[model samples]
Target: MGRKVCQQDHGQSRQNSNGHSNDHLFSTHVQAVIVQLSRPVLRPGFRPDARLWRGGIEGNFEVTISMYDASVGLFVPYLRNLSALLDKGVAYAEARKFNPAVLLGMRMAPDMYDLAQQIGEACRHATVAAALLADREPVALPVLEHDMAGLQARIATSIEFIESLPRAEINAAAERNVFFRLKNGTELPFTGRTLLLTFSVPQFFFHVTTAYDLLRHAGVELVKKDYLGRR
Candidate 1:
């Protein structure tokens, strides 16, 4: 995996009428995997399918790590990136094509098992990035495999870890480079402008949508509800 990049950049902060920073609503790292992962799979010929290029699968997997790193290192920067790509002016189809710089070497494949392995690797990266962003020394990626059961287990574990972080930790900082210490004692840095517009938005949805594409191509009997996962 590539070295984690910081997402923080300076920008104006949005605030609610009550004078509290609205950043928490957007900046705090939400465990969006299930919500993102649950999106209905798209097949070839779909509107945004062009985003799934030769390296689409691998690129998507790499973004998960990027998101984790962004969240821990610079929460606001990640949110800003996410907000820009997800903005109404940006067509969802066009947004789908966005890829972060950090995912340069990830590879895509045609087989289901290989696809599963890619997702597993992405999940592992997410785990490490999350810990590192929290300022702890990096830990080994959890054991994962390509089987459906293994994927489910890994996803469950990742979600639980994400949920455990303090909600305040998700809010945007006044300045960039606010660092968090992870359990292993490493510092992870963050920023606002970069957080919102750069790494966070593009990397996250890219993999999620690609994962859906892979499953759909393989003929998973997926529907909108399946994508939403009972939320």
Candidate 2:
């Protein structure tokens, strides 16, 4: 005899259901992790100087590229996260509502990394504008394109325009609902929930992991213990 609806084998169905649930859970975890580590305070024993962290290894070190490379890897993923939020029209309240306590289950650095955090936020904003104008998904772009002088000029102009506006004006832009229209005239609406679930969450974690890996490879005193912030 066939099993009843409720008793019918739900293993496959359950797995699919769980997959979606896990995606949201993971996204929440990422944001929570970011919030905890992006704080203003530094973690115990973290040296600001790269060489100090390297201990006795003396050979080659280029400050600019070294730092920039790490920062770039760390920043891009966070940027995608932010852009995903913006593209989906997530309210500031919702976006900023992340609480560190909920993320206790996850392993993350105890001290906030300010430079990484700030750059990540900036990337988010920049990517949001780029995505909107290009009529592409927010996570579609990697680092903002460095094409030509004209492109650079336009970005500068946009920044200046936004900066010149009153606080109200900026807020209005942030809140004003609009659809992303492609050059072909198709309109795409921003769906915050969808973006968070699908792209932002995964991309953000990927970048964070990459940054962590780069730091570790560079001889930073980071081990699995450091990621967990455990003694």
Candidate 3:
């Protein structure tokens, strides 16, 4: 017997080809979620919502621009952690009758930067990242922070520096070319988007995580929650 019948969707499986492809609908929905959460594209003036794109796309330049802010945003927590942990670490060392300087100077590897340098580098990256993203001149890296108080001040200063920029200036940088010198003393230019996603953001996190690792390796009682400051 030859037959054709409309089947109602009960939400059991994603595939429904009777009238429309539920499989396609579900697949597109998942892809959109991934883009919004992780892999956002940088397209100036391109709206992210479904109403505008009409293809279930889920992000825009604004979302990508927000990454710069979020890059700085993540540093906020890093700074706070460093502040609290530095105090706690000092106390821990005092309790054990060990000089805190030894712990502060320790690194997971001999070839790597020490805790003070790690914290300084993290702050420096944040400062430079915000300036480049906003298309402004970077503030000169402050004199290297030595003590815990100096480190905390450096972090706070970086945050203040980033927050001082106008959002419009940062957003306007989507099309701007940002020139930066490589370690080899040669300059490499990048569009603001590439600079953030490829260079600044990664460098910021690398130092942050390294700072965290330095603290944890030195036996500071910092859990993962300490790494990611909560709301």
Candidate number achieving the greatest TM-score relative to the actual structure: 3
Query: Runs in model 3 with CA error above 4 Å?
Result: 1-68
Residue lDDT tens for model 2, 174-207? 2334464444898656543333334434554554
Lowest lDDT block of 10, candidate 3 = 56-65
User: Which 10 consecutive positions of candidate 1 have the poorest summed lDDT?
Assistant: 81-90
| Superposed Cα deviation of residue 108, candidate 1 (Å) | 5.5
For residues 29-84, could you state the per-residue lDDT of candidate 1 as single tens digits?
Answer: 33233345345567655443322432243344322223323454333222223222
lDDT scores for all predictions?
0.41, 0.35, 0.66
Answer with 1 or 2, whichever has the higher lDDT.
Answer: 1
Q: Write the per-residue lDDT of candidate 3 for residues 1-231, one digit (tens) a residue.
A: 224333433244443212333234334665666556453458876545534452323222112224434555555666676667677777878888987777668887899888888877777777776787776777666677467766777777777787776655665565688876754788778887787788877887787788778777877778777667665
What are the candidates' C-alpha RMSDs? 22.5, 26.6, 13.1
lDDT for predicted candidate 1 compared with the true structure: 0.41
Candidate with best lDDT: 3
Q: List residue ranges in candidate 2 displaced over 4 A.
A: 1-190, 225-231
What are the clashing pairs of model 3? none
Give the count of colliding residue pairs in each prediction.
31, 2, 0
